[model samples]
Target: RVLVAEPRRIAARAAARRMAWLLGERPGGKVGFTVRGERQAGRGTVVEVVTTGVLLQRLQRDQELAGVDVVVLDECHERHLDADTAAAFLLDVRATLRPDLRLIAASATTDAEGWARLLGDGGTDGGGVEDGRADGTGGGADGSGSERWDGRPGKPAPVVSAPGVSHPVEVVWAPPERPVRPPHGMRVDPALLDHVAAVVRRALREREGDVLCFLPGVGEIARVAGKLGGLDGAEVLQVHGRAPAAVQEAVLSGADGGRRRVVLATSVAESSLTVPGVRIVVDCGLAREPRMDHARGLSALTTVRASRAAARQRAGRAGREAPGVVYRCWPEAEDARLPRFPSPEIAGADLTAFALQTACWGDPDASGLALLDPPPAGAMTAARETLTAIGAVDTAGRATERGTRMARLGLHPRLARALIDGAKEVGARRAAEVVALLSEEPPREYGDDLAAAWRTARHGGDPYATRWRQEARRLEHALTPETSARRGTARGGDGPGRSENGPGRGGDDPEHSSGDPGRRGDGPGRGSDQRGGGGPSRGEDGPGHGGDPRGGGGPARRGDGPRGDNLPTRGSDLRGGNGPARRGDGPGRGGHDPARGGDGPRGG
Candidate 1:
């Protein structure tokens, strides 16, 4: 009945499990979750936790969302591309399709006014004011409470603030004594890692509770974990996206009462799920951002200084249970220069899949949708060209039947095309196996050759290989030949018929068909031997020839000079001249034979 969308699958599962715990039941609890490759909800479930990606997919299939009454977009401040797109479409539904639907966007450090304006007065200019009372108490006549422009409420949506539980968290600035090279690309200076490890050790010795250290990424976590090995009787754990599910679960479970613990984690631990008993926080003051070099077609993660808002969130983790301490790795004065918020993914991410989704949703340009930020024009054009190349869209930028199928596959458009086309090239099983490897890229040790990686994944004992096999089986079932054929036949009428000449002929212009330059005589100007002009002509290959000379299809008479009696020669004066023709002779003129001028032929 109620939907909660999280940015990541792990977070969704964690939220669902936590909600189920609160319900005091298992197996058939009132709260459940549905993510890719997993579903836990039952018929009696009241709250269904799902990833933003899953929510978007569901909306694409059923715009009305059937029985759903309330949709809570959790962690909206993250600003993921799918979340933003989902929010826009949800707003569309709220505006026109389902006015009764209750949409709630939740976040810890969100731009309250921006979101209130977006969802409040229907994204229009409306203002009001509220007292800046933290305890819902009245303010003094001086208006000491939160005041907007001239004490007027900014929008219709009221800003509700829940006072956080009070806990005295001591802030400790532990900047490195010596200068270290700043984070560049995905690399963090090793010196900073060394300092963070020292801080973790110091926290273990002096602090009372377990230590939770935040690093930029997995690599840094591993290095810091290694450096902290000297801590006797302490259990050190690493938590990252690539960490095994059991390990991540163990990290969240906290350490046994007898042992001291140190948990090294990436930004994944910044919010949402709590690490129990973490009273001392070691902040490395760095985070990774997704970067794309569109010119080189390379996408990678880049390290950057953490935002101040993120620092606050990290510090809050330590105070979840009791009074705590936060050791910031950077100088307190430097915090002012940090970015106020992380960049939205839509602004820089490759939008091929987004373009396909919009096209399938019948909004190809995505102009009609109410997105916070419209997809960049150049990126959208590139995405359309990619879709067109893969037969996902027609020349008119409409989604083809194949495109619809691809979108339903729940994969990137490129990977979907590979899976569909690969299945036809090879067997369904082989294609699925290959696509599964691509879906979760093979380990570098698996080698660069995909064929080798496929073989390794089939026979290797690595965890990645195990996951790949499971995914391959799922893909194989989804892409059976019969199913593919049935889908193709069912939607065959929806797609334009393929032309005999080439693909994308549905919207082709008859006057200027995009045919091969060599394939003459198939349409207008086919018989023309000339480069620019068009007519039936048989003459030497030149700019003025109108047709093929060998076939005599040209407009000129046989054995006639370049300027025949019927054809005018370039620059040949009708009054009989050798050089440039006069404008009085005809229209514009250039070099033409004077011998064939005047009344000799129709020269000039």
Candidate 2:
């Protein structure tokens, strides 16, 4: 069996289909694909294409990749963190467990030598050189110069040279007439999108084939696509990670006969999938890279100049079928000034998920994995710290059972935690839907309201909605039996905010929990014929003391001031507040506990 790792989901599916077509069969027949929430493969499949993240999961589950004879990491130059990690894992497998496994890293642009060295020496560079092929067969005479594979484990993997058929891509300087400000975190100058849109229009007028314009992010793609509006004789589509699956398919499928297309895409198209009729490329010369704001303890995508290699790859999209031209939105001088290659995601991106994967794979700190570049120490530490807080990993950075479950859900730890708790509070279906939204953010058109966005998904027939439903279902199914059962139990009446006393019925501390901040007796003693926590006072309004409105029954006292005393709360906020919730608020009655479908919180 052959497993091909692609950086993006679209690429995985498209590559599978293309390979299956070339084999004169439908996908899942001889070639199949598996992405995060979907799979189109059968046991009869011989070649399977999957995204790097999927491959990582497979590796964590089965380190040996049993029965898999060949593994191909495509588009290695892209430097996606998952791909790099998968590559490192495969190298480890070959060196230790599956010595017979054949590995191939297919990339056209980056330093082939560097990859060969990394692949050969298990991360260390110094090694004997080899010009021969590994085990597996390849073309020696097709004239395309593409390397044929041979399986073998050697000091540094063999470097097979490929000089496939090519056409010249003419570069044109099409800088904006007016100076535009450089990009900042997620902010691209609107003027640049305007310039890019104009360039697309100009390319359509002057160039012949379909135009593929590279934008920095999803927002930029959307803006340029809007500027293109609805073009006559051409279909304008947006392509990126968040693009509606249908829209992405349309881009991959190409336009109708005699119809042109202007595909505004992110860098995913750089080497992932080749748009069908692309002959004119509009290079926006911008890209978004992940950056960890250490001070703020958050990760953000900062827009910057696209690396020269990325620009070349984007420009090469135009010349895939015939001679084409690339309209550089920046002057040629700037091209020379750009970095030679895009930074690897591991360097700056949040490493929590990656760290979790490493922990699951037995490399708690990932120090042993063979990588093109090591993940930053500070980033790894931060990630481990987060894992510890979420209880996803132990103090030793080892994945806990919960962490393993979270990893299998294919979500970030935070979202995974939300899903688990949400299922108990809400239901499996509801938790799945919301988590799916957070996982692959809704399209811009979905609006800023999450609830509204969810409703749109529930009723709309748009591709985003379609994909969301599919993902939501997948997530629901992924929920553990324990979690699903817990949700069912909650719905059956024994869940959060449901104690038979009042809204916040729970084990109570004495004296208004002594956490209330009102003047001495003003807090109204706890046992004073009144409760002031999750529920209302049994008697009157009671004291001026509500313990903590901040929920969490965490460290604060019931109806206490903000952040409260250091003493722990009696129990979780599950039962309304610091005391037993009233039967009305309980699951069986007309209580207004928001946990279920109830309207809101109610008094004791």
The prediction achieving the highest lDDT against the true structure is 2
Expressed as tens digits, the lDDT of each residue in 85-113 for candidate 1 is 78778877877788777777776666555
In model 2, which regions exceed 4 Å deviation? 122-154, 230-232, 444-447, 481-604
lDDT of 2 by residue, 488-509 (tens): 2111111111111111101110
Count clashing residue pairs in model 2: 38
lDDT of each: 0.57, 0.58
Against the hidden true structure, what lDDT does model 1 obtain? 0.57
lDDT of 1 at 197: 95
Question: Where does the lowest 10-residue lDDT sum fall in candidate 1?
Answer: 503-512
